[model samples]
Target chain A: MDFSAVRSVAVLPFHDLVGDTRAADRVRDTYMGMLLATRAVYVLPSGEVNRGIARASIRNPQQPTTDEIVKLKKELGVDAVITGVLREYGKVRSGSAEANMISLSLQMSETQTGSTIWSGSSTKGGISLADRMLGTGGRPMNDVTVQVINDLLDQLFE
Target chain B: MICSTSCSNRFLLLPLALLVVLLLGGCAGLEHTTVSSSGNTDLPARLEEGALYALLPIENLSASRAPLAELDMQLRNALKERGIRLLEPERLETFMREQRMRSRGGINLTQSRALRDLGVAGVFITALETWREGEVPRVSLIMRLVQSGDEPEILWIDGVGRTGDEAPGLLGLGLVKDVRQLTAGALERLLDSFVAARSGAEPGTAAQKKRHQPKYRYRAADFDPAAEYRVAVIPFLNVDTREHAGRIVGLHVVRQLQRYGNLKVLEPGLVREALLSQRMIMQEGPSLEAAELLAAADVLGADLVVSGRVFAYEGDAGESKVDFSLQIFSGIEPQVIWTSHSYGGGDDGVYFFDRGRVPSAHELAGRLAEAAIGDFAQ
Candidate 1:
């Protein structure tokens, strides 16, 4: 989590395990917007990063090889890259109860060493006690998503 | 006892019938009507009604998991009802499987040739853009007819988007509660236009839907208006929160480009096929990079390439907002020829009580796109 060597980062598209085809892009977009707003680290424009990825001919976007990582850095002029996976992101139901949920993990790797510099995971939202007691639908999906992303960012910068 | 029971039942039904009649009469002013209309009805003259046609699988571009199978069936039935000869479903399915055609949303030149060999004259490519079923239902469907020949050219294309509560009568009881009925009404209107065009009725005149002189626009000074340029529209980058906003905007731009007589707009499916084959991915959004633009133009055989970004396409509480920018690059050289930025809300010009307010984001996007490309026609 050292910030000395990491000046810029490329956030790859998150992998979605959820059945929804759009979950990956939607979550990644939110992450990009929030991460950029923090202004903690210089983030490459998604278009530039994608161009680098395409130019490198990386077969797997979320899991680029070490050599591909170096190539992406050379192409995009970024010091580090971030990859993420969305394990569960949507509404979950248990019998008669339903609530929004998000489970995600992210890792940052420096291009020079091509090794993971920092990694974090976050999971939030479910059928809560208050939700059940009041018979409410729980938090909106966007709220849960933002909360999970915020938790991860806090860990990343800690 | 039986006679007494029958008499009681009749007495009960008479009052209920009377009540129904009274309510209907009272709510007559509030009758809701399904409004479905299309743009661009000028179909190719060579298209014959007797020619056999096949409906490719309807593409579901909507965020909602609309019943695509039901829609396909409905379209097939509607085609049959209109006396249009369709290829046998089993035969078409077999051909699709044999050819390993993964994308039925569009037909490439090779597929078109193969269909021609199979005695099919044309193919229908349909995309269900929007389908929301609830208290107020909304449906948007776009259909295109491509001739199955050496060159797979789009013969006719039109789309219709409608919301259930688009027109509420006196009591609001006229609201359409069922999505299927709304879809049917839209389909009926689309077919009517197609039928009318085929029967030699003059295609509806192009009406000016939206007009705005762009504040930021660039056009090449030496641009020729009569140039026969082949154009390919890339999927616009969706930076908006709305799902599929990029594709929707791109489609609207394509529709606008198709209206220009000097430009030959390439089928989006073919453009997609080329992009995939070339392994060119616009990951972030539209890129103005010289190398990539030239590569795309060469691969797609496009004289001009169009790319764009959608910043906003959202509708909340009956107000619609759309913001986007479009850039057209020359294929011969990796340089921009035309660029324009457009942004507006549904109530932009509405002063009085919502007389000119746009009802949905889809329509607003269409108008913005039209206004952005308005100068091109001149």
Candidate 2:
């Protein structure tokens, strides 16, 4: 589980369990934004990663197998690979109170050994005290998403 | 030591008059709509400013069969005005014809490879999602810039939705009376945002976010006081449209329904999976036989199923409008328990001026869904 030697990582598109087809790309993009801000790891550009995916014909980029992970590492020239699943993304309500919510989990694996190194999940933003008292409807989706990724990154660095 | 009655009355009236003036002043502004830009703001840094670009034929998703040639023309002019380089119109036309390119709004890798042959650096694609004509026009336009190479990638994607009366200034001077003006304004705003983002300005520079307030209402009888309800929202059926209007509206409804603490709304993916497993198809419309509804509810472990159709979702002018209806069925009895229809513009609740206008069909749909599902919270 030592993360000292990890350098560049390719973040594949997150699998979306939310019915909205657009959620996957949106969530992945937001995650990348926050991840890039951390300066903890060098991430491969999404364009190159997507090109590699198409070249390899990886059918399920969200759940790449070990063989596919190795192939992606060879194709994208990255030391590590990251994949994720978006369990929830959008709005939720508790009685009359409403707020934006997102639930997602991520896993990172070393490309050479094809061994899972780090894993984390985050769920945040739902009917906060402010939403209940002041009826503010909580933070916007973008803000909530930022917070979620921040939480996951915090866990990763810790 | 006593002041005259007239003097005391004058003093009181002056403050009241100022208060009235201040309130009215808040409502007195030009009609304007805010554009929210997301996606890769870092695109500009990677793009060569002087590189030649190509504009794909605009995609029209509006219900109106209006000719989009004028809009395309305007787009070309707008791009040129911003000093963005583009291929010659005639050359571009001939290339599209020769290549037999029918695609719009997006450019794939193959297309990008082909465009690269012409020494194009990037491709600009636009979609006109809503175009309505009336006293207050509404228009929604989405534009994307994709770099053309072995790996075609979207550099920037932004959308602007505006209604003609979005910001009627003092005495209504700011109302966008013409669709052309609204369209031009939207394009300008989008390009400005892109430029600002590339120039290292605040990428999140967006208009003030306004919260949706309930302006309309439809009340159902009542839920059993003691019994908790499980709700399932299914895919909405689209009528006379090529757009994914149905799914968009359904998501809005799901978002609104989840705001209630008493209802356990099932994830839509599970509902879709259950339907697929049972091989249930409601292709014609969302209407289902009572038995079919009950079967779906049973598999989803829900007490109610929500389904509907999108009739009209237009925002191509100055006032965006959404028209859709939803019906709820009882899981146990296959009986219809609630039905509601919503059809209105983004400017529905604006009183004095444009302060409360919505300006986008997406946001308006969310608010309307909130109104239709308002009774659930009670």
Best by lDDT: 1
DockQ of each: 0.10, 0.01
> CA lDDT, every prediction?
0.72, 0.68
Question: Best TM-score goes to which candidate?
Answer: 1
User: Residue B161 CA error for candidate 2 (Å)?
Assistant: 8.1
Worst 10 contiguous positions by lDDT, candidate 2 chain A: A29-38
- Give the range of the ten consecutive residues with the poorest summed lDDT in model 1 chain B: B29-38
Q: Against the true structure, candidate 1 has what lDDT?
A: 0.72
Q: Which 10-residue span in candidate 2 chain B carries the lowest summed lDDT?
A: B208-217
Residue-level lDDT tens digits of model 1 in B1-378: 999999999999999987766555434322122222323345636677588999998888787798988999999999899999999999999999988899867887788889999999989888887888888788877777788887777766667666666554435655777999989998997787677757655444333444333435666666675788888888888763578778877877876776666778888877787877777767565444532443453466687888767766765235667767676766666545666666667666665433455555656665666667667646
Among all candidates shown, the one with the greatest DockQ = 1
- Could you tell me the TM-score of candidate 2? 0.47
